[model samples]
Target: MSSSSTSPGRDSKARAADAKPPMREALVAAAFQLFLERGYEQTTVDDIVALAGVGRRSFFRYFPSKEDVVFPDHERCLADMTAFLAAGTGDEEPVGRVCDAARLVLGLYAENPAFSVQRYRLTKKVPGLRAYELSVVWRYERALAEYLRARFASRRDGNLRADVIAAAVVAAHNNALRSWLRSDGQGDATAAMDHALGLVQSAFGTAPPPPADERPEDVVVVVSRRGAPLWRVVQEIESTLTRD
Candidate 1:
């Protein structure tokens, strides 16, 4: 008995298929490669799909548009940041907590330095990408502001304070993040971010004091002669209270 033989060409084709990258990753890699070869505007969804060896449907399945491919991980990172903020115990200092949330964003960039730097450079060159990036940043800022608003709900001008501090946190984080990206991801990004965030924490991180009613009552003690005159006793008590 004899068995049928597989052709060498077909065997090579099978191996190539096996070696292909995952669909989503392949799409992203293809999109960036095309973006670099032909400027962002010159590149189209058809080009990306063609390079990725995927159908247009597959490209849209992973990314809504060509711009989304450039910022592939942001949506996931944003979800993580929102979850992190929501998980807070309410015992954390609001400013410090929000600063920590900002770190999550830095962590995302740090995860893939080469890719992040490439994307950063691309964003700098593309006005549309820059606008899209700004919108994404705005979403992050809003998440932080919402968390802060809840934390500061009982404070005077709480909404204003939350919005301001949230903006500050985003500013500080982006400042550090962009610097790191500018450096080609060299040096300690965490240190840079911490220093920036430290400023925010120092400026607004103090845990708000408990409500006036919740504050501990002040205690006063007055010393006087055993047979002190009422007027003198009253004077001493008033002086003690005033001094305190």
Candidate 2:
């Protein structure tokens, strides 16, 4: 092991140690680290890029602004939700389908519990981040409503129904997700989501009415004076029961 021979091996090890995380992940990690240490408002994009060992171009490529980094996965998650809803066959129950779609958001949070909990706490402290988060939530709700609108197009008040159901799904999902975050991600998030979404499903997921032929025949009851003639009563009943 001559000194020159050992030099190459040492250099290679140093390179490995110095290698940076993937650019996008690096940006997010650096941003959160700074956000926690120095308040989010105090930390700038330049500081994040400096820590990430990347340029401003790289940071902007991944995130439009500081707030976007706080919620890195939402764009990807929203795209996944859109694709999931678009792939539906239209045969599924709309309310139930929306509830399932809402679960995808829970899955995103559950994928990194510690990170989720950290972000949750951070958002609570920052009113701007909280407002940004609400806007992100509205986008998700809009996606669900759009999908439901197409599914329910023929029904009366279809648009209204779609919007209402979409709101319910979002409300149920957020309720469960925040509960899990508040608990420090301790319990079964999926089960809690299921229970919350189940309520939405139960409230709005009634099966479509049976086909006209499969529906049971309508029954009619005739009310007549006790002294009225039996024939008159029969005539009245027949008229009431007759199909147009």
Model 1 RMSD, rounded to 1 decimal: 11.5
RMSD of each: 11.5, 10.7
Supply the TM-score for candidate 2: 0.77
Off by over 4 Å in 2: 1-21, 207-244
- Give per-model TM-scores: 0.77, 0.77
- Candidate 1 Cα misplacement greater than 4 A, ranges: 1-21, 207-244
Per-residue lDDT of 64 in model 1: 81
* Cand. 1 Cα-lDDT: 0.88
Q: Report how far off residue 109 is in candidate 2 (Å).
A: 0.4
Looking at model 2, the pairs that clash are none
Residue pairs clashing, model 1: none
